[model samples]
Target: MKEMQGELATRALPDLVRDLHAAEATGTLEIEMQGQRRKLHFVRGEIYLPAATPLARRLAALLAEEHSDGHELTALVQRMVDLTSSWREGSYRFLESKDDSGGELVGPLPTLEFARLGGASTSPEAAEAPTESRPSAPPGPPATDPLAKLGGERARWITVPKRSGSFDPAEQWVLEQLRQPRTLRDLLEDSPVPRAELLETAAKLAAAGYLRSLDRPRVETGAFEFQSETLQRLRLRIASFLEEKPLDGDLESQRSRVMELLATREDLDHYQLLGIGPFASTDEVQRAYEEMARLVHPLRAEELGLAESAGALTELFDSMTTAYLTLSDNERRRDYDRQHGLGPEAATVTETSPTAARQEEREELARSYFERAMAYEARAEIHFAIEMLTLATATDPTHAEYFLNLGRLQARNPNWLRRAATSYLRGISLSPREIPPRLELARILEKLGELPRARVQYHTILRIDSTHQVALARRQELEERIAAENRGEGGLLGRFFRKG
Candidate 1:
């Protein structure tokens, strides 16, 4: 195709970019707008500004200085989104002849979708705040508006030939007032344009290429908000709670019992799960169930206002109830023993069980991974963040908090909900006393349409903390939903039941 050239005023830069991307065009896009000349060298419609070139290197350096994010292409595209969104009268030429016309990838990035998510960022680990909500420092004058520094040296922000696009006499008069670089504060004080109208005009004129932001955007200090390992780890431990304090002895022991049941010897048969010999009598089983209840009930957690603890405790108690029910009957207990290869002589599991030893033998090299995972999350590098957290969980699978943190990050994206479910399951398995992961796991399960499993999760949570509003409400919702589904299936009993 012949080289294409057009005035930016006729077609916006983003639209032009979309067209180039749609056509999968291979070329160098040359743009002269907003009183500045720019070039975007693309290979098959993707940005390929190799740092081997001077322009690319300069742009890279500027992006590195201005944007805290490490992904160079993402930052560059974000800058393009910001600048191009306002372009009014600029000329763009697309030349399909380039050295890298072979379609070799520079980086698998800066796609149209990638550019859209650039404006906002959320840290997957520590601290949560929208970047747009934060105030930007005006280069010259103090303004209450987010788009501060209207005039003054900031006036040069529009660059020379501020009147780049065609404008009426009134518009020309406004440009004349801005000929001298000055603060927006002074312009509002001295100019005839109303406050609202001036801002509106400035925005409109800026988009039409009448004004240009000559300088790179100033990122506020500490915008990324990376926290220390100690603080972030503590935050992970606390889950949704704002404060962190040592657990009470009784609550801690109860949590320990739940963890031991959920994780340490999870391979046990029902008899072993209930901590009894295969031939234990009904009374013995009853005694064991009662003892386990006292150890695993959420009442202590509820009393201490530990919602997280209560959630996990509730889950443990549910399992104990199942085990109790199964072992309490002679036939079910015998059937369970046969399935698990246990006999009447099978001994109770001891501290030296192979499962516990295997857990203890896992590597503890997750500190570095944890640190990088947070940094990657803050940069919106979800893939890298997931990779790092996966490594962390694998290397130190015993750390309940690590799994919890990983699940939290995975839960941020809808596509990752399955992975998030796995992570939460692992977290609760490792630290069966933590209520947050259980609640999250149930929520994710509900979203995934695992209603029965979610209902069980909520039921367990209620077992620990009877007053849990969300669990109570969601469980009722799930009950109704499941019942409705049963009715649709033509079941005589619309009040449905499901196995965990």
Candidate 2:
């Protein structure tokens, strides 16, 4: 194809880009303005390389100084697009080429997102406010605003742009809710946040191409009218929120419960722990961390009189904090994903540290032994089962499951209760989030007539899982029993003093 050349005086850059995108053209776009030249490579209409010039190098250096990774590249592209948009005297040419080497940046650059970025780049104040533009009411027979147009229909997510730094909590919440199509009215009813804030967030999201209205023309004038069904749903939600009572059990039980849960589950990586997918924006990670911290922090535990479980809560909080720190840093997040086989080049990459390899090997051996132990237990060979479980624990002391099983087997004999408790403690130390080992230990302590210790364990379990039926029942029963015993002792002392 012949190279297309033009002057910016006659043709606007945004119009040129739109034309190319509409045509699905693939090639390099070269722009020269104010004695500076930049090359942007396009692959089938998507922006593959926004800047292939000395400017990109300077941007890279700046990003390095700030300890950022992919965000700098995105910022540079946005800057270039913004600059090109305003150029009144510049020469532009599109060179038709089959070269598809540039793959670092992956964005189709939706028209809406491009427009928003342009607006953001131009006005500093606009960029600071997430919701600045309101869609003009479409002119027709019946007047219809953006919200009116989206009245009965749900908004489905198309794509979400990666964001850096802190995000508005309301915006983040709205984005999460938009993972699936939800109507504006539904969101208003569901979210405890202000209706105005939610509407603003939804409007911004729709404008950014992150959301698309399912139906264009649907309106109910009295949509907010109180209906019986809607009232019932709202009531249920309110009740659930208000029903969250404080931990009623003791601290030790809560710790055991958490440990037991940790033992049965497969180990979760940082991304999984934060409840986010790979390449999630730093803002998303921080929001997730903060939400989790509110539920699992030691301060929350202490408030509920579960202070004895503080050590367990602290370990969990530390791990979560580490995950947040690693994921918030661009370079560190990339390296972590790469190491965990979730990176873009993970399929082709075969990199492993010596320590990691050894750990994996030991875990495999421990699993094999654990399986054998389970088989022996199934056959009713208690001695052989214990021996195999011991091997598993010795092979991979870090494996919570191994220690949990060993503890359970040892607890079968009353004479070995202390040893079983010790084993459970080890498992808890390795995996603070596991709950089964901790639960078993609490039961063992109770059986050994250690009421105070058992009470702590029960409270700890409730701290981790408030709706745990066993923990709730045991804790309540223990409290009643302790109260009755105290009352009986007081009566006996009173009678004895009166006789004297």
Candidate 3:
């Protein structure tokens, strides 16, 4: 009834079994030796082995080979005991379950003779003995190695201590799994080693407390802080959807997407509607249609701000569905294309990396959002412009121009100065050699009253481009003011560092 758990190295599994036997405890003794797990069932002090397990079957086979007459089950139990008693490194737990063992048993154990050897080989070479000679568990139920079911490539983990150095092939593979906060799925997928071995080794390491499972974070959304109500509303809803763990749905662009779909739906042919060329490869067309479906999914109407124009949205979606149906079929696609007079160009599969392909797609989509952002900026719809730019940056953060413009727009609002500074920093990181972002960053820093940092930034700009007039003038003026303040004379803005 009391707590029961400890390492076998010190506690000794034999001693623990003797305790359980003395208490007449009815339950299961779970042992984890390195990575291997084995269970012994007890019915009021008498031990029982789960039928058909490797150890059980091995003991049974050995009994027949020995031609033992002294209760075959007795010899087998002793053999199981011998194997377990020989284990010096492992952990153990005793779970009391008199009501039900949750285990199917083959036979009872012999504890009086538990420590006695049944002439069964417990040697290192004996462990490598063939399965036919060993008593294997019964096939009543599937294997209980539930950890092996962590078969997903997306399942991630983190390493503890993040220690390094020499490792066996298995250890090395597991280390790769824990190299970063990446998923075991990715680790297992990328490795050429057998999954069973890798998983088993990982299990052993985990048992030894060498690895830790991670609650991995979602994919990056490019750090968007939406500045408009509509976009913010959509962002929150998409976030909720993601939290609910949908199989797959569009968490990409929303309101503007509906507008784009409505504008082009009627004019573009089926192939064009699907955003594929006449001779587009099958995979390309399929992917394009999937994107279209996500955008026009009727369930997304309210969040996308298309509820008012639901009729148009519905019509566009129908066109998309028709396009997919037609283009997905080779014969139908060919006929539809012929009627449209779109002659086929050789459809060559470029075999581009999926990551590269996705990057290119994002670049194109973000460009559209960027152009729309500029239009909104031109019309003085600062909030709308900010939203579009947010989308552009979130979609493809590699573009320096997106962040530069985003910071500039955000700077127009006094309350957004801090965020503006962050945006400018991101832009500078992406475009270190480009002067525009650094200049804007300097300006934002000044507005935030970070005069010293602003001055430093200006100095950085001058280093990059000595002829730049604005940076030269700003840096010189800041230097003079800072110098004046340090000299105990108040500068233009005010005294800095209390004139000390």
Q: Which candidate leads in TM-score?
A: 1
Give, for candidate 2, the lowest lDDT window spanning 10 residues. Answer: 134-143
Candidate 3 to native Cα RMSD, angstroms: 24.4
Candidate 3 structure quality by residue, lDDT tens digits, 1-500: 68788776555555556566667788888888757777768777766666666555544565456565566556455445434443556788998885654367644456646733422334445445453454322222135452433433345554443233466887876765564456665565444454456667776665443554443223211112223454334445544554564425333334533554464354345654665545567888878866666566566677766678777765675566666666767876665543443424111112243332344555676687788788878898887678778656655666778988898999989998877876676566567778877787778778777676677677767778999999999988888877877776665445555544
**Cα lDDT for residue 174, model 3?**
74
lDDT (CA) per prediction: 0.56, 0.57, 0.60
Candidate 3, residue 290: how far the Cα is off, in Å: 38
lDDT of 2 by residue, 391-493 (tens): 5664455567787889888999999887687677667766766666668878998887766567667777787898988989988988877776666633677
For model 3, the superposed segments whose C-alpha errors exceed 4 Å read 1-357, 491-500
TM-score of each: 0.31, 0.29, 0.29
Candidate 3: deviation at residue 174, Å?
48
Separate clash counts for every candidate: 9, 30, 15
Window of ten residues with lowest summed lDDT in model 3: 342-351
How are the candidates ranked when ordered by lDDT, highest leading? 3, 2, 1
Kindly report which residue stretches of model 1 are placed more than 4 angstroms away from their true locations once superposed.
1-364, 489-500
Better of 1 and 2 by TM-score: 1
